[model samples]
Target: MESGRWDELERRVAALEAAAGRPAGPGEKDPTAPATFWALEGLRPQAQGSGAVVYAGTFRSEAGEVDWQYAHHVDDLLGAPDAVAGVDEGADRGDLAQVAARLAALGHPARLAILAAVLRGHDRTADLAELLNLGTSGQVYHHVKALTTAGWLRPAARGQVAVPAERVIPLLVAMGVSS
Candidate 1:
């Protein structure tokens, strides 16, 4: 892009920061430009009369002024270092591995659909089979075994299967459904 266009983008980002009530960081940038969106740090403070420092990132959505859709991305960008730094390697690895395994298990669309149905209170193998269009209870059980083995899913009290609370965020993050 031309320098003029870059400057304009910066201006728009700055406007977004002002509207967002806080300064923009790397994550606030457009997801399309992942590099710029996550690399901005150590911004100089706003000039004394400016109220607050505001750095521009990128425009995400047009539904409203200065789309806030990328706010969480910004937060995650900022928090990543600290999150990694503070990790209890031992404690976290267990969860991390579990999360990774679970995520991998649900990586397929069929498995993901089945898991979603389970999370939504579908329990019995018959129901899951019906929801997923699987031919038999055995097929649903086989897939459920895959998820349960990885700790990505479990059977709820009422015989409904659900994702464990602790695993929800990782699942969403893995699925790119959440930041």
Candidate 2:
């Protein structure tokens, strides 16, 4: 890229950052920060300002082994406005610990499979055990306890377990089971 284009890109990113109310200093933190859209390599701003921005950019895989170019609207990229809105900036250590625990609960393959089974309507403990081919019901319940304690699963009426309604889409999206 030419110097002029690079400078323009930097200026635009700065403007976008400013408009989004991001703090200027490196160590400064904002409790209620808005979503930040990266102007990745080869990104071209299509339209900006007016409470929204559009860009043509490459979405790179984690390993940088693949890249897909697509035009993206910033709002759409951030997901549902209501979902992203009103986020508390004052999240403390306890909040972070809870998040870490929740993520850790999904780290095990058996736990992930169990969650997937529940998502697919296999809510019974015996059914989940059979689906995963575990040796005993105790093992299934152990994983179930982890998931339930992490707030991913809840006991339904009878002996079945379920993913809470509000968590269904978020969990599936996190697991890459849904877009």
Candidate 3:
């Protein structure tokens, strides 16, 4: 609203545009940005440093939409936009926590043995129960539920279960079946 405020915003936006390898001009599109980047029309820049501007806003695309975002110093968006890396700051840590919780579910020897058995194509719960000497379909089912909830196992079909594809590699690596 104030004169300095607009100037500050402009300076910040210019630095961000430069860092992102975009030429500065109102309505001039960023050539390096993703095809969907122009959807960032409402972006308002905020200066984070003397030569750095953080363009923070939402981006819309067919993949859906991302909100509360930032585009930082990057040479090109033709690659990946150089933004914050790793787990997003606002991501549901609940999912990350799920990994450890899943590991804990698999921590039991009986469960681990069952997962190994299932992963080996012994899809029948009864078959796994017999292999583990755990006895009965009910006991195996209980352990199976634990692994399933943790995403370590999934129902391959009715009356049959299997490990998820993503978990297969990790399971094999944990069991030393993979290199």
Could you tell me every candidate's TM-score relative to the true structure? 0.44, 0.49, 0.45
Per-residue CA lDDT of candidate 3, range 1-179, in tens? 99999999999988886987865378887666566634334333532333232333343333234445344432222222222343343333444455568768867889888876775567887677777899888999999998889888888778888776556655655555322
Q: Write the per-residue lDDT of candidate 2 for residues 1-120, one digit (tens) a residue.
A: 999999999999989988888765788666566435455323434544323432222222222322223344554445444444535333343455576798899898899889888766
lDDT of 2: 0.69
Rank by TM-score, descending? Answer: 2, 3, 1
Tens-digit lDDT string for candidate 1 (103-142): 6787667788886665555666668887778878887788
Per-candidate alpha-carbon RMSD to the true structure: 14.0, 16.6, 17.8
Give the best candidate by TM-score.
Answer: 2
Our model 2 lands, by Cα RMSD against the true structure, at 16.6
Model 1 residue runs over 4 Å out of place are 1-100, 177-179
Cα error, residue 10 of model 3, in Å, equals 70
Evaluate model 3: give its TM-score.
0.45
For each candidate, the alpha-carbon lDDT, in order, equals: 0.59, 0.69, 0.64
Sliding window of 10 residues with minimal summed lDDT for model 3:
74-83
Q: Which of candidates 2 and 3 is the stronger one according to lDDT?
A: 2
